[model samples]
Target: MESPIYLDNNATTPLAAEVVDAMAEAMRAGYANPASQHEAGRRARRVVEAARERIVELLGGQTGGRQPDRLIFTSGGTEANNLAMFGLARMAEDRYDGPHHLIASPVEHPSVARAADALACENWQVDHLEVDAQGVVELASLENLITDRTRLVTTMWGNNETGVLQPVAPLASLAASRGAMLHTDAVQAVGKIDVHFGNSQASSLAFTAHKFHGPLGIGGLLVRGDTQLAPQLFGGFQQAGLRPGTESVVLVAGLRTALELWHTERSARLQHLTSLRDRFEQQICAELPCAQVVAAGAERLPHTSNIAFRGVDRQALFLALDMAEVACSTGSACASGSSEPSGVLLAMGCSDEVVRGSLRFSFGAQTTPPEVAEAARRISKACKHLERQKHR
Candidate 1:
């Protein structure tokens, strides 16, 4: 029997062979706690430090120059984002003047959007940036929303569902002019597209290895070296007490290997993913007239595709695809199992029908043309049947 075609790369990716090998090597070496004074502990610490430096360099973060960036390890994107928001906010507490304000697009990941909600509950003024019909965040809205009181601006670089690329660089500049730090959840963008921390000017950036064919349970938050982030978790002085906890040497090894693979094959991977995505969308639209690709006009990640099949319920389509041995999603993996419509689509002002009918299909670096073709056929068949039943 054939295995189910996995099209949910944005949610998570399968571990790569190189990453598995690196992890196994780390375990075989029996790395000790990085905090200890022994030579073995120092060896483990060196691995973590090397991985940190390499990750920053691979992502185009500042390295040799003044104010080089720092990478803070976390459990995943959620913890990293939380550390960015609450940590930055707390650090800036001594400088707070009036009602502290924050700016974010409603299309942010659950981690960010919910963090904004928590801030709002504590009397912080929160403002949302507007996006267009294609789900691109309007820079003009940021100009109007960002004020002197705004301490932070949060946005996702590449949206997980629609894959719309935000105007993050220009937005960061605008926020900087207002003395507001910018944070971007670059989880979906890091492996799919070229991301430069220095060029992006995002005060802090979050990414997870699992989203890029590495191990789970480990992620990084890149921030300026000069940035003073208050520690959220209190304990020993590991990670400068910012994210104080024992680091996972094996997971770091896996992440380092996975990122090394991407650095070597970045261009090839992009081209392949673009080809697969284009082929998948073409196949779906050719046979299913009601299926419209969402945000196709916007600059997007090569791996993600969101389709809205008119008159077809998203849940029914999802179940049908599951039964047909194809895997996809409605929106962010962190927000899975909710019956609510996609917050991203809703933020883009999609119609009720469009929001109700949309599904996300994200390709992986390992996804092949044949899998895309077959997945498209299965999706077209499922949506066509569901649409017909709806009409009946």
Candidate 2:
């Protein structure tokens, strides 16, 4: 059987060899629980702390300055987001801020959006900022929605589906002016783009390791030193009690190695991905004349391309590509099994037909020109077949 051409990096990525080797070494030599006081445990603790330092350096955190001591490790992006929203929301509520409210974009990942909705069930006001046709949050609407009672503004740094970068700096500034904390879900942007948590206006930021060729089940939240958010968990004082558990030294080591690799090779990798993405889209447009590339004019991530076929069902196209040994996504992988159209597309004012027919193709380090060319050819052939069947 032939190997599948993978174009779904946004969903997850293959582990880098270096990361895998690091994890293997940790599992063999640093398996002790980081919380224990024995010498072996101290060795494990040292490993975890070193990994933290590497990640902090990658994110531009200072060694002695007012950097956040609140690096909380979690299972993944979902948990990080939940910790931020729930912890901050409860903090605001305890302060008696007129039923403290939270604001987020309508197109946020389900992790953030659902957490906000759950908070609303407890009488917290949750408002959604609308996005424009370019899939960007309208800054004016966000400003208009803010009130004296607003306690937090949570938005994503990079959209998982469309890979459209949000205007986080302006939003962070707006939140600061109102004395409301800002949180950005940077899970998709961490290793893929330059993320300077120290310089950013956001009070807290979240990121996962697997999105950048690291091991799964390891992620962290970056909190500013002066942030007032409280811990969500109670136990040993590990991770400042914000996330309490024996740390996974193996996964943390893997994440550190991945970040190191990214720092060393980011510029060259980005240029390569950009060239491949452009070639892939150009080939698709040349072959399928009726296809529309979504957000083509926007400053999208170098690896992602969302396109729509006028009359073809995206699910059918997805299966057809699968049959051709090519892997892609209809939209966010979290929404993969659902029949509903993407909320991101809807927020961009895309018509229902376009939403249902849209497909997302994301490239990564392992994606080669030959694979991209083959995937495009297969997609073009599959789409043509679907169109013919529709007319039959």
Best by TM-score: 1
Q: TM per model?
A: 0.98, 0.97
Pairs that collide in candidate 2 are: none
Candidate 2 TM-score to native:
0.97
- What's the TM for model 1? 0.98
Report, for every candidate in turn, its global Cα lDDT versus the true structure. 0.90, 0.87
Task: State the local distance difference test value for candidate 1.
Answer: 0.90
lDDT of 1 by residue, 71-106 (tens): 999998999999999999886776776579989888
Give the Å error, residue 123, model 2. 0.9
